[model samples]
Target: MEYTELKVWKETRLLVNNVYDVTKAFPKDETYGLTSQIRRCVVSIPSNIAEGCGRRTPKDSIHFFHISRGSLYELETQLYLALDQNYIQEKEHKVLLDQIIGCKKLLNGFINYYKTLKTKQTINH
Candidate 1:
């Protein structure tokens, strides 16, 4: 399946875009610190999903999804830090946080479904 066709991938892409847009307005002093960390974590969301999808096994896909989840948490933490540092307003922070949470839900759903499929295949075989 194409990466674009996956709901989790699509949502993750959107979330990453949102993070980029918000981080663009971050304070100039944060160029090498919070900004960099936040960008990397945001990028990891879709990157992991694509990497997992390219793998030969469902277990690999699930592993990448788990990694993506860890990145999502990292992004969330950075977002909160940005808010606390006054880099982003509460409203913008909340919106981005909501998107992150949504993407996480989608990723978890995909992981669960993939695991279920793997289990069924094992049982049938």
Candidate 2:
């Protein structure tokens, strides 16, 4: 399946777009610091998903999914830092954080399902 057609990838792409929009209002001083870090983490989400889908094995796909989840956590941390530093307001922080959490949950579900399918195939074989 095309990565773009996957529910997890679609939601992740939305999360990344939301992150980009929120970061646009950050202080100019953070351009090289929080801003860059946040962008990279957000980008990693769907990038990892796409890379995983291109792989030859389900194991490789699961590995990339885990990496993407790590990036999701990284983005979540930076988002909280942005809120604590007053770079983002409480409402904005809550909205983006909720989206990040949703993406993580969806990714986790996808990973579990993929792993289960792989295991079942191995057992059958």
Candidate 3:
């Protein structure tokens, strides 16, 4: 199963791209601050998802999913900070935020699905 085939992964990838694009316009002074932190957190979301897809066991994969979820929340907080700092305009903030929220929901759904699968596997084994 290719990671790109997962909707959650694909959506997170888009979110990461948006983060990179917007952070490009941030003040140079924040180059090593919020900008760097945001880039790392957003990248973690999809990167973890992809890594999870390659894990040898369902349980192992789910661990990566949890990591990805944590990264998403971190990204959200950083985005809010960016908004408060006026690094991004309201319109840009809204669009990026909406995307982040949607991606988070999708990640949650996938996590639940995988947990259920692991439970069923345990019961049968």
Candidate 4:
């Protein structure tokens, strides 16, 4: 299946939208600071997933997936920073956290699936 069709990728895409929507209310001064950083981290999640899917080998795919997972964690931290800075409300922060948790679970499963394929390929060879 195309990476875009994957549940994790789809959910991450939604997260990108939700983040963009929320960040719009952030201070104008943060436009190039936290805002930009958050945007990049969120975009990386799905972009890396797509890149991984395009890779020829399972190991190569897993590498990109790992990067995506790392970005998700980074984004999670940034969300907390946003909350502490009062850039977002507790309710909004909770929603984003929940979405991140869901994406993490799905991405972890996807990574494991690739790892199994890698193991099988190694055994077959």
The most accurate candidate by lDDT is 4
Per-residue CA lDDT of model 4 for 64-116, tens digit only, reads: 99999999999999999999999999999999999999999999999999999
- What TM-score would every model get versus the actual structure? 0.95, 0.95, 0.95, 0.99
Model 2: colliding residue pairs: none
Better of 3 and 4 by TM-score: 4
Q: What residue runs in model 4 are displaced by over 4 Å at the alpha carbon?
A: none
Q: Write the per-residue lDDT of candidate 2 for residues 32-103, one digit (tens) a residue.
A: 999999999899999999998888878888999999999999998988899899999999998988898889
Overall local distance difference test of candidate 1:
0.91
What lDDT tens digits, residue by residue, belong to model 1 across residues 20-125?
A: 9999999898999999999998899899999998988788788988999999999999998999999999999999989988988999899999899779878888
Q: Is candidate 1 or candidate 4 better by lDDT?
A: 4
Clashing pairs in 4: none
Note each model's CA RMSD in angstroms.
1.0, 1.1, 1.0, 0.5
Who is ahead in lDDT, 2 or 4? 4
TM-score computed on alpha carbons, candidate 4: 0.99
Model 1 regions lying over 4 Å from their true place: none
